[model samples]
Target: MQAQDDFLKRIEKLNEIGIALSSEKDTNRLLETILLGAKELTNADAGTLYSATEDGQLKFEIIRTDSLGIAMGGTTGVPINFPTLPLYKNDQPNLQMIAAYAAIKGETVNVPDAYEAEGFDFSGTRAFDQKTGYRSQSFLTVPLKNHENDLIGVLQLINAKNLGDNQIRAFTIEDQQLAESLASQAAIALTNQRLINDLKKLFEAFIQAIANAIDDKSPYTGGHCHRVPVLAEMLADAASRSDYGELAAFKLTEEQMYELKIAAWLHDCGKVTTPTEVVDKATKLETIFDRVHLVDHRFEVLKRDAKIAMLEAKLAAMQGGDAEHAAQLEAEYNDKIAQLDDDREFIRTANIGGEFMSDEHQERVRAIAKHAYVNEQGEDAPFLSDDEVYNLNIARGTITKEEREIINHHVVATIKMLSAIPFPNHLKCVPEIAGNHHETLIGTGYPNGLTKDQMSVQARIMAIADVFEALTARDRPYKEGKTLSQALKILGFMKKDQHVDADLFQVFIDDKVFLRYAEEYLDPKQIDDVDPAKIPGYDVGA
Candidate 1:
C-alpha cells in the first residue's frame, strides 16, 4: 500500500510539473523547470539538459548539482561553457557517450551504477568525480521526443538517493518512467512557445513592411511614416509618468505599450491606397510635371504677338513715308512688352506654394488669368485658365480642395483596413488608436470627426506626435521644415483652438519631448532655440 501511495504522489507531482511548464513563456526558465522537475521526481542529486542542435550535436542548455551547490545556464545567467556532445563522429553515429548514445537510440538508458557500467563510455564522468572528490554513479539518460516523434533533447540525471537511507543508488524503474513523462510534456511546451515567438516576429515584420511601402510610395512623406512612431513613443512615456492631468489616471502595461507601438507603426497604413500623384503634389500645378510651364509658353505667345504688331506698323509707316507714326508705335510696343513681362513674373511667383497667400497676390493671379493669347486652334483664350488660376491661388499649402479630399481619404482607408483585422485581446484597440491619429479635440477633424470626449488618451497622444513630426519634417514637398519654435508655436495655437489635448500639449512642452525629437530628426537649421513664452496658446512656467 505504501509503494502504491508513493506512485500516486509522483504522478500528482508530474501533472503539476506539466502545468508549470506550459505556463512559462521564457525559454530559459522553461528549460530550467524541466531539468529541475525531473531531478525532484527521481530524487537525483545532479542533472543536465541538452538541446538538439541542427548540426547534429547535443548542446548543453542547463546543468545543476544540488550536492555541490552548482547551477549554470538558464535563469542563473551563468553561461554553460562546456562543449556540445557531437551526435555523429566521422559521419557515423557516436555511440560512445551515454547521453549521445541514448539520443541516437531514442530511448532511456538506466544504469544501476556508472562506476561499474559497461558498453557506454564513462571516462568523462570519472574524471569529473575525481576533480570534485565526488563519486559519480546511477545514470538515467532519457531522450526527449516531441509529438512528432522527433528527438528534441536529452534529460540525464545522476546520483539518485535512497529514501530509507541517505546513500546514493540507481534510478528505479518508476523513476525512469516519471522522468520520461516529464520530458515529453516539456518538449511539447517548448515547441509551442517557439512557434508563438516565431509567429510574433513575422507579424511585426509584416506591419513594418507595410509602413515602409507607404513611405516608399511617396518619397516626400517617407520620413513622416517613421518619425511619428518615435514621437508617439516619446509622448507615451511622458504620459505614463504624469502625476496630474487627463492622463494621470491612465497607465499602460507592457502589452498595452506593444499595442500602441503597433498602432503608431500602422497609423498611416491607409496611404497605400492613396494616389502617389496627389500625395506628392509638390507644386500648385504639378501633375506628372509642373503645369506652370504650359502657362509660361502662353506668355511667350503674347510677346510674339506684340512684336508682330510693332513690325506691321513699321512696315505700313515706311510704305506711307510716316517715320513719326512708326516711332510712336515702337514706344507703345516697348511698354506693352514690359507690362507682359511683369505680369508673367507675378504669376510665376504666385505659382510656388507658401504657408499663406495674401489677397493681393491672389488678385494678381486673377488678373493674370484675364490676359488673352491665341491658342493652338487660333482661337483667343486667357493666358491662364480658370482652373490654373484656382490652383495657383490656394490660400494655404500646395494641395487644392479636391486633392486634399483625396489625401484625407487615406485615414478612412486606414480605418477600414485595420477594423477588418481580428486582433487578439491585447491588440484589440489597435484599429481605434491608429484610426484616431487624425482626429481633433474641437470635433472638426476628419473621417468620423471624433471630439476630445470621444477620443481615448492613446489617440490624443498620437495626434500631437503626428502634428509635431509633420511640422518639423524636412522631407515634405510644399514648404521648408519649420524651426522648433515655429512647430511649437503652431502646436500652441492648436491647443488654443482645442484642436489638441490641452494637458498632453502641456506635457509635451514641460517634458521637452519636442527637443528630444528635434535633436534626433530635425536639421540643425530647424533646431533654433525656442522661447516657450512666445509660443501661441502655451503657458510657460505654469
Candidate 2:
C-alpha cells in the first residue's frame, strides 16, 4: 500500500509539471522549466538537454549539475561554450556517442556506469570527470520525439541517487517509464511553442511586405512606412515610462507593445490604392506631366509672334521714316517680350504650390488665362488654360481640394481593409489604432472625424508620429523638410489648436523622444537649436 501511494503521488506531480509546461510563453523559460522539472522528478545529479539542429547537429541548450552548482544556457544567461556534436560524420550517422545514438535509434539507453558501459565512446565524459574531480556514473539517455514521431532531441541524465540512503544507483524500470512520459510531454510543448513563434513571424513579414509595397509605389514616400514605426514605438515607450499626467499610470504588456508595432507598420496600407501620380506630385500642375511646361511653350510662342510682328512693322516703317521708326518698332517689340517674360515667371512661381494663393494671385492667374495667343492653326487661344489656372491657384502644397479628398480616402480604405480581416483577440484593436492615425483630437480630421475621447491612446500616439515624420522627412520634393525647432514649433501650434494629443506631446518633449529619433534619421542640417521656453503650447515651467 505504501509503494502504490508513492507511485500515485509521482504521477500527480507529472501532471502538474505538464500543465506548467503548456502555460509557459517564453522559449528560454520553457526550456529551463522542462530540464529542471526532469531533474527534480528523477533525483539526477547532473543533466544536459540537447536540441537537434537543422544542419544535422546536437546543440547543447541547457546544462545542470547539482553537486558542482553549475548552471548554463536556457534562462541562466550563461552561454554553453562547448561546440555542438554532429549527428552525422562523413556520410553516415555518428553512432559512437550515446546521445547521438539514442536520437538516431529512437531508443532509451540505460547504462549502469560510464566506466563499465560498452559500444560507446566515453572519452569526453572521462576527461570532464578528471577536470571537475567528480565521479561520472549511472547514465540514462532518452530520445525525445514529437507527436509526428520526428526526433526532436535527446535528454541525458547522470548519477541517479536513491531516495532512501542518497546512494548513487542505476535507474529502475519505473524511473525509465516516468522519464519517457515527461520527455514526450516536453517534446509536444516545445513543438507547439515553435509553431506559434513561426506563425507570428509569418504574420509580421506579411504586414511589412505590404508596407514596403506602399512605400515602393511612390518615390516621395520611399522610407515613410519604415521610419514611422520606429518613431511610433519610441514615443509609445516613452509614454509608458512617463511619471506624470495622464500617461503616468499607462502601461503595456509585451503583447500590447507588439500590437502597437503591427498597427504602426500597417497604418498607411491604404496608400497602396492611392494613385502614384497624385502621391508623387511635386507641382500643382503635375499629372502625367507638368502642365507648366505647356504654359512655358505658350510664352515662347508669344515671344516669337511679337518678333514676327515687330519685323513686319519695321518693314512698313522703313519705307516711311527710315531708321528712327524701324528702331522704335524694335524697342516696342523688346518691351512686349520683357512683359511676357515677367508674367511667365510669375505663373512658374505659382505652379510650385508653396505660398498661400491670395486674391491678387488668383486674379493674376485668371488674367493670364484670359490673354489670347495665336495657335499653330492660326486661331486665337488663351495663354493659360482654365485647368492650368485652377491647378496653379491651389492654396498650399501640391495636393488640390479634389486630390486632397482622394488622398484622405486612404484612411477610410485602411479601416475597411483592416476590418475585413479577422484578427486574433490580442490584435483586434489594430484596425482602430491604424485607421485613426489621421484623426484630430478636436473632431476636425477626416473619415469618421473621431475626437480624442473616441480614440485610444495608441491611435493618438500614431497621429503624433505620422505628423512628426511628415514634418521632418526630406524625401518629399514639394517642400524642404523643417528644422528641429521649426518642426517642434509647428507641433506646438498643433497642440494649441487641439489638432493633436497634449499629454503625449508633453511626454514627447519631456522624454526627448524626438531627439532620439532625429539623431538616427534626420540630416545634420535639419538638426538645429531648440528652445523649450519659445516652443508654443508647451509649458516650460512644468
Report, for every candidate in turn, its global Cα lDDT versus the true structure. 0.90, 0.90
The residue-by-residue lDDT of candidate 1 on 1-542, one tens digit each, is 99999889999999999999989988999999999999999999999999999899999999999989999999999999999999999999999899999999998999989888888888998899899988888999999888888878999999999877858988888999899899889889888887888999999999989989999998899877788889999998988888646677978888888898999999999999888889989888888999988988888988998899899989999899999999999999999989988988877777778889999999988887888778999998787878898999999889999999999999999999999999999999999999998889877998898999888899999999999989888888878899998899899998999989998898898889999999999889999988888988777766
Candidate 1's TM-score: 0.89
Task: Estimate the lDDT of model 1.
Answer: 0.90
Clashing pairs in 1: none
lDDT of 2 by residue, 298-334 (tens): 9999898889899999999888868898998899899
Query: Relative to the unseen true structure, what is the C-alpha lDDT of residue 106 in candidate 2, on a scale of 0 to 100?
Result: 94
Off by over 4 Å in 2: none
CA shift at 329, candidate 1, in angstroms? 4.7
Best by TM-score: 2
Superposed by TM-score, candidate 1 places the C-alpha of residue 357 at a distance from the truth, in angstroms, of 0.9
